[model samples]
Target: MDEQNKNLILATVLSFVVLMVWFILFPPPEDTGTPTAPTEVVQTQDGITVPAAEEGEAGAPSLSPTVAQSREQALAKSERVEIETEHLTGSLSLTGGRIDDLSFTQYFETLAPDSPMVTQFMPAGTSDAYYALFGWTPAAGSVPFDQLPGPSTPWSVESGEVLTADTPVTLVWDNGNGLVFRRIISIDENYMFTVEQTVENNTGSEVRLAPYGIIARHGEPTDLKGFYILHEGVVMSTDGELAEIDYDDVVDLPVDANERAAVEKKTVVENGWIGFTDHYWMATLVPSPGQAFTAVTKYTQATDTYQTDVRLPVVAVGPGETTSSSTMLFSGPKEWETIRDYQNDLGIEKFVDSIDWGWFFFLTKPIYMALHYLYILFGNMGFAIIGLTFAIKALLFPLAYKSYVSMSRMKKLQPEMEKIKETAGDDRMKMQQEVMALYKREKVNPAAGCLPILLQIPIFFSLYKVIFVTLELRHQPFIGWVHDLSAPDPSSILNLFGLLPWDAPGPGSILAIFSIGVWPVLMGVSMWLQMRLNPAPTDKTQAMIFNWMPWVFMFMLGQFASGLVIYWVANNCITFTQQYLIMRSQGVKPDILGNIRGKTQADSK
Candidate 1:
């Protein structure tokens, strides 16, 4: 194919890939949903009934707790209810029955003052997973939780309500005495405790019930203050059944409730179960599946602790039939010694589903793991990235070297090939045959250069994924003005001088910006250096076409992770050094460097 056509084809393909990546990272808002679907449970004659549609809606809860006023007032009144035990020390709120504050001042560092670090779960409002019902709704009035105008009247506290140190107190609410509610508190060496909420309908009639629970946040979810982590585990069949489901093979699970024009969402898990976060994490799971028509919803979060809320929406029962639902709440860390507290495999680790890599995972996973370990060990992700890239380059050295040698040989034979082209003049078939025959006799492999580049493509993709998702590199620091290598570069002279986006960073930070800005410059320089060290295409079109390749690559790479950019920068530098050494060893003149001797030699030539 002619150089013009190749460039056109490559340009089209590049544009398409860019669009796809843009959409993947910044998907349409409509695509977001909760992790768990709304659950609907019904008992059939043969077994349990669960409608997938109902389950889909489990995440979209329109009902929020009735606030006395607005969220600002509630937050202002968030009480610091402290509980002391050898096993646990934290503060919760009596107002929202949530952990409004947590401190291990003597146990652990303060984390931070404005840090939204919670001792209990605090779900991200923007994330489509485990959405918590808090803040305030229209019914509570305008002004959000954070923007509430001012404090409102305090909520009335009933007398004799105290969270004391003694036999653990239990919080109970029953419909027997017009839905009486009570609070019980306790302390112990073992903070392990079980909360059993029993709801029985005794109005001599069936009444619909929606079980809702609330816990306060010592902090809210924020991008700046989250500890990135994952859960891993397996699910076993019925009690002692011994049968297990391989949760390793990932399936797309719901992140939030599906919203439809008129359809109701539901989810049903017949096998009663529980869940636990990693060892340091604690959680409370409330399972309340009411009568035949009950729809139950479960959600959880993590801070310094974990809070799981189970919402049960019950429908009417037959007049004569007494209906009841029970929920067991387990709250504690997932420490091996304590995880067993919430047995039935709840404590078992279940890794979050990740994107698959086809057959490449077998090879890429080890590389990723190695890089991750190094990142954690050194606490400097940029260095780890450099090391990983170097390892990959070393492994592929033989192939790349052969490719370079082949290209060099091709360049040496170019004069002869051009003579044949001139002699064949317009006889395309004859020219092609001559070119093939020359390649055959010379023992040249046309594909020798292509294989190495193709092999590197997958490796590049694999590393991209690793850098993008590996939590270990999230906030890791690096040396000399470049800290938090996982995030965008934090230093930018252009930005400092107001010539760029004030939030804009140096080349390593924002992938897209860096690609469009710094990548092209580096790539151009690298490619120019490479060209000077080796063959130059005879055809002006081919030379011009190849000259533009680096710019195209730079645009493509600019929007990649800072770690990836650093790797490329190192790769280019190393490649330039290698090619320069090769040219020097081959007795090639160094006119490209423009030294006084080089200039004189070039002038003489």
Candidate 2:
């Protein structure tokens, strides 16, 4: 094969390799069933907080190794202040003054009408005991753990009965010996909560304590997606540096001998937050914007806890002095618009990074912006994907135009090139020299045709990552038979599009790889038709590769997000039109139909 054909085949194979190997290498992590809730119990305090590293060296508070109660039973352990906001519902446990129970009022666990609201935090005793706790950590040589309020501190309502956007709740606990603790929690119309924790010291001596916020997940999330592309673990921003540590990596964090847990700690001067992020929802602790704090991530295998803590600097209170610390807690869905608003309005630096944009952020971010606007304008994700494809195609139209024009010129040179080959016979050196002279004389480049294909590789991968963003695409319906664009195309040919009584194969079933859905089949056809715009390769093996490529991708990607499949189909159709127009402008009308028939005849022969 000529160098041009060789490059074309290599590019095609490389694209195939990337598409196939990515999923193969990084298949979803195995689901080792959510951290088993403590099965047996002795003192049912829900769960105990593991001792901290030290009073001075702040570390995350995690569940202690012990048995637990069910979520309802755990919630019942403490007197609670009911939380009711526009977008959130749940209660704050007065025991720890912890916002341990919350569910998104706007979202459901599934598309079904009866599906439960999506729960973001569960009480300490639940199988997935996830919660956010704010309290005082005593300074060195200060009061004992019991003296200051903790995860299990029993506080009584000091103010509001029900917590609402307009009505904030206050809980107070007095040590009686010398210190009194009060937590005033106020919720916004959305997800943010302002927790103002104050401690009044009435003792004769100086008292010192550090305020902190802890987000603890008793075990890995029960609803963990475990998908490689999606991040579901400890996601934090320290001094504007974003870090996404998986649950496995959290477990592997360096040991903090003082804390007796695997810990990673960072001292952030300002502009940071720490939290656990599941696929769609997140619970993060954002220190009062300008406040410096020690951010820590911790994991304890024995207790099966993953924790992130934001510990503020130590504050000292003189005799009869009172001090308070205000912090923000975000516990809700990761809506791009909402997070972006928080970042822009409240100066939550890089808060949007909590959403995994992946390595292709350069492309993914811009593509997501375009797609996001399009979704809003069109009011349908399917159309948004197609609109995104068109916007991208239009942006690259000039390069595509040049590529197609070059391909036309190369086609014009084919006849002369064949004569040169005939004249040179078996003299390979002479044939190459003549071909190079012919190309240089014509002022044409053989590689231009591959630029569009080369560009598609990154764009395709970026869009795939975008679909995994979840909030925009999850449970979103596209045109018809596509209930969830983030999920696979549901209608399968194997079930004759539901004509057969049997249903399509489940996504996890091995047969799902071949359960070609309508969208995937249409995508394959679009790709095959696009290939027909050019004459088949002269080499039988190369031609065979080109012929089978579409079908190979169809089978391989049938299980990908249907939104991506729609993008591919749109891209193929647009490309086909562009190439055809460029070909016609060159006075060589593309006979795609004839080429398809000719290929069939030749293959049959």
Candidate 3:
């Protein structure tokens, strides 16, 4: 086949692979786990669960058994200690000392001015309950259940009233049996909260218990994107290895009889953290770096709840000994900078991996860092994406220059190729031999033109995952009608990019296929312009395929994140400029207008 045919095939295969592979993996691989939910709990992971502690040492604030309740009712059941920080605001439930009412004060649900703030950690008993509860999992027969702080143990404010960056709060609960439990909770300027669990053992006997942290969600996230590209379930890091378990897979974990939940447990000899990760937000239990712990992913079938637990080493508290354990909870948007700081400064192992960087993390990480800095520099995520395209093009310039020069030389040899074709008419072997000889004589590689695009394949998917998964672009605006960069362009072609007053079909509707957005249309046009820089292929099939490839890609990506579409358009425009200049330098003026008008090289001559 001719160079045009190669280009045509390369372009087609590249686009399809990107689409399939970057949903991370098409139909994602089936995980190795029990296919069905655990029937009956026969055994539990060691150090995971213990029998009910004796009823919360009688006098401590006690509540009736927990049942489903509205968020307001749940909040009302326990007096809350308000949490205040620069980026976070929530409350600690005094009843359970749970960080159960958190919301990002800076992030909103929509572009509307009155949009509610993005909330996380709704109180337990609420329909969409999510919370981080910390306490001890007693060693079997080590201590009475009531002696340790359990989910419903009411805590009295022992220190600061409101938890803040400047004021950490300490809550205390005594079992009256000789165990006095104190929890000191502190938050930094960002999202991480450090909880120190201290036990004052007064009894003459020794108490053995393991401190544990739990992040439990009543059900799957209501806003679960369920997009194969995004992970909306349990994400954990064990001893430098990262794992993501979908809600379904978590349910399939081997059953633990004592906990009556499907449980998957791994002992992390050193650093590890575990929790649920949404598209933009996450809530995780981060143990101190180098702290060995048992990481558990659990799904309680009885309550339809999903949980990630970090169980610390068991501590032996002798009479008059005060033992303590410290762990952290990260609950908020998965901002690259914030998570990175925790990883680099505070030493939370691979915390930034908390964002789904996908398989192309090698490229995604750097691309995101560049985009993040660009956003900070420009104060606009859309511009940051465009800057990112420029950066990538810059990096690939040497290769792209060679590819364009090769294409330019190929165009110059087009007339000779036509003569060769005429001379060898129907003698396919002779034609192939002559073409190869011509390429060798001219020092031109027929396949060199594909280098830049081939290189673009991974970069394209990497950028897609970065823009689609990062929180930096969420609700960010570029220009008009593109209010949320992480979302598809809201402008619709059915209405002439919103020239019509009516709203276009939403992404959920079938009509969405016809609802190409303004940015995607521009992407198509840019792609067409780039392709036009070279003469159309003589083969009608290849010509038709090349003609439609851009528009086809445009529609396919119309429903994708706007930031990615912007990046593609920028990339195409840059490539067009580079090719136009390089070809002009090589002394072959591309007849772009003629190509756009469907004029082949022969017709142009």
Candidate 4:
């Protein structure tokens, strides 16, 4: 094979190998678990039944019996502290003082305007019950279990009538043992809620207890997207190190003899946050920064629940003194700006890492930032994406210029290379040596053509990650028939470009490969035109492979995010223009149209 063909094949093989390895390491998670009805048991005064545990156990506080009820039934069972904000509406259950019921006021379950609001959290007694509960665990022999407010403990609204961004609510629970436990819940204009718990030790003795926050999900979300690129389970950052624990991994954890879920704890010496992240939304506990705490993630097999906890260090309150602990709960959409604000303004270490930027975070972050700024400037994400493409091409113009110049030089030297091959027929080493000598004498780099492709791999992956995982891209519109850039192109050519009544094949289906969309087809044409900038390879195998590559890529990337497809199509056009101009600058006029006509005639022959 010729040097150009060998390099092209090597590049193609390497690209395939990289993709295979990436998929192998992070394949889309399979929906593996079947939902089983939780066994019902007697209800306790606290509303839900709690299994007994040994005193002073430093683990998940206690397991609550499963209660299956509708979301309305569960909400009606408890007197709630209404939560109202410009962007959120939910109620805090007074039963456990849990921030349970929440819904985004702006987002909907579907694109239809009448679709129900996106619900984020629900209290116990509901299927897939998810809620956040905060309280203190008393030290053994220091305070009785009953003395501390349990999950069922009734809390009276002591301060505010309604909880709004400006108004805070305080729930008071008096143990009647000279200890008063007060919780002050305050919210912002966004989704963050600050919960401050104070215990007044009027018992005439010192008492020790640890403040703990728990976010529990009864079962894996039934609506989990399960895509490999997006994280949909436990995500935590401890002392700047982040971990994403999938639900399946949590379920596979080793259990105790009692069948309790195994607990995995990481000590955060400085600052951290722990919680659950959905595809677009998240609920996390942000403890006070600059303090040591224990972060725990566990799955309870008995209750079929997944939980994340932030257990602060034990504190002792002296007689007639009050000790207070504060934590922030973030329960809302994973908007980049909001999360970044929390990370910077609130000093939450690595809080923005919860967005699942994948392995190319360094590239993805800056790309998203530039895209974000451009969106702000252009007032359209589609334009922002196009602007991003222009910016990227400009930044890489120098390298592209060199690469195309070298390619033009190589094309000019093709005759000399062929002559060397002929004279050194069947002598591979001599052919290679002569080719090297020719390349050096002509000041051309045979490998320069590969630079642009090599650089594009990471850039492509990063853009894909940004479009796949960021909330800003969700439901974003570009142009006609492209209402959601984060999703695959909806218009398919198979049904006469939606002229027919039949629907396109769904994603992940075998037939989906053939359901190429308009953008993908355009991308394929652009790529093919770029390939035709040079004459077809003399070797039949090489020519055939090159001919098929553009179509293969077209189908392979048809199901990708529309934003990424747009980027690819744009890149191909820019590359074609760049190579054409650079080749002309080198005085080598590329006969693109002639090349196409010659290839057609040759094939016809």
Error of 4 at 66 (Å): 5.1
lDDT of 3: 0.79
Question: How much lDDT does each candidate structure score?
Answer: 0.41, 0.80, 0.79, 0.80
Residue pairs in candidate 3 whose N, alpha carbon or C atoms collide under 3 angstroms: 41-257, 53-145, 53-146, 54-145, 54-146
Clashes of each: 41, 1, 5, 1
lDDT by residue (tens digit), candidate 2, 361-387: 999989898999998899998999999
For residues 57-130, write the lDDT of model 4, one tens digit per residue.
53333434545788888889889888888999989988878888899998887777688999999877787678
The candidate maximizing TM-score is 2
lDDT of 3 at 422: 87
Q: How close is candidate 2 to the true structure, as a TM-score?
A: 0.91
Cα RMSD, each candidate? 11.9, 3.9, 5.1, 4.3
Q: Cα miss at 308, model 3 (Å)?
A: 1.4
In model 3, the worst 10-residue window by lDDT is 38-47
Model 1 bad stretches (over 4 Å): 1-72, 76-349, 352-365, 421-430, 490-524, 527-539, 576-605
Error of 1 at 532 (Å): 5.4
Question: What TM-score does structure 3 among the candidates reach?
Answer: 0.89
